[model samples]
Target: MPEYQIFKNIQKHISLSDSERQLFISLVVEKDIAKKEIVLEQGSISRKLYFVEFGSLRAFNVNEEGRESTIMFAVQDWWITDMNSFINQKPALLSIETLEVSRLIEFDFSTLEELYKRLPKFERFFRIIFQNAYIREQLRVLDKISFTTEQQYTRFVEKYPQIVQKVTQKQIASYLGVTPEFLSAVKKK
Candidate 1:
């Protein structure tokens, strides 16, 4: 199985026994997603967490004006989901879509619950994953409040050079809370 990528991601914080690894592999479903495919739409209940095996995805929200505000980008080895909705089984605040043709490992919430029961170690792994995700988002918020637009752009580039190559300036601008025109100017400087 081409599931080694997911195993590698899991191994970052937790070690799994051979049988536990096999069980995890059995629970996840691998999917081939096309470019621009919306995996989770706003207002729908979020049920799955997607791990990018390859390619890229973005989570963003559209306002009443239909303007998109990017929340985050996920490249290979990264996980993306509408965390609030997924955790609570509520309507999603963000929509997740692929930026490129992608392969992903999908874990349904029920399956995760099962995994947690069968292997308590998975709970620790996910706890750490959520903590790291929270920290990254907290830092992003701090950056927005503390840095200039150019500095924000620079930090974003330094942090996600792989994503910068995969997505458009408009998308990057949305993530940075700026207009595409403004991003163009930032790039010029």
Candidate 2:
């Protein structure tokens, strides 16, 4: 599918004029990354916002023991990036890497800023997106604190059936704040 279609799908809830759509398209660059390739690494400034066109990507943070804790995953039609670094222009605490060979539409912060200035309507579109993301993250956090491993696994499967098959067990375990062995046990029961 074309990058424009991905943008259009995301823009479905927003009102955009032809000129604004063109302007938004002009700001993004399409690129492909191979599986296991790092799109954004920890300690680096995250310069771009990525819209996943195909395949999957994982965002994770490493602890003192160098164990990776998955923060989020993005698959086709989803968006992925280090929000903190992208917004603050500071070094990223998270690393984003492709789990499968992927195509992405990337928008740099400067270009995004320019688009916001040139087409103020786009600000509303992005605000809605950000708000939705924030709410989802909050819900995920609440689930993590309130639910058991089995409950989380059930909820995850219910929420993202596609992801359970596409993502590896270890990645899924990390996302659920569990060890791979525990995830396997949960699955067996």
Candidate 3:
């Protein structure tokens, strides 16, 4: 396998020997998804976690009124998946779709299980990843409940300028819990 962002991502978190690294790389599979492709749809089981090598993706859900609420966006070097579905092998409530033609590396759950069993350090690697994910979710929840709209938008723009630039104005508004008009007014000031 050629060198990819996934290798750098894992190395940043955990040190792996040459053999272990090869094994890990062997388990990964790559795919190219076109824009508007739905990788994981609502009610489908999410069997793999995807690492974005290039381009962007968004996770979202539609409510009874048929409004789409953006949950999260993953760009280059970021990992995205439906956590509950991937972990429990249950149906996902969110849909993960590509926003642009993208290259992603998928980590299969069963293969990861084997990695954890065969290499203990990988367990630490996943633990750190999951822990950070949980913490980020918690902090995002707090931010939504406490921060003003402008504050949230400012932080969102600062943290994910690439996402903001790639997604449509309406999508960004939905993600920020604001109306498109409001977002436009905010942008003006």
On lDDT, the candidate that comes out on top is 1
Q: Runs in model 3 with CA error above 4 Å?
A: none
Model 2 lDDT tens row, 7-93: 665567677666666767777798989999999999999999998888899999998899999999998888889998999999999
Candidate 3 local distance difference test against the native: 0.89
Please give, for residues 1-189, the per-residue lDDT of candidate 1 as tens digits: 445688898889998888888888888899999999999999999999999999899999999999999999999999999999998999999999999999999999999999999999999999999999999999999999999999999988898889889999999999999999999998899
Off by over 4 Å in 1: 1-3
By the TM-score metric, which is better: model 1 or model 3? Answer: 1
* Residue-level lDDT tens digits of model 3 in 67-184: 8889899999888999999999999989999999999999889888888988888899889888988898898899899998888888989988988889998888888878899988
Model 1 error, position 105 (Å): 0.8
Higher-lDDT candidate of 1 and 2: 1
Candidate 2 colliding pairs, count: 0
Model 2 TM-score, 2 decimals: 0.94
Ranking by lDDT: 1, 3, 2
For each candidate in turn, the TM-score is 0.97, 0.94, 0.94
Model 2 steric clash pairs: none
CA lDDT, every model vs. true structure: 0.92, 0.88, 0.89
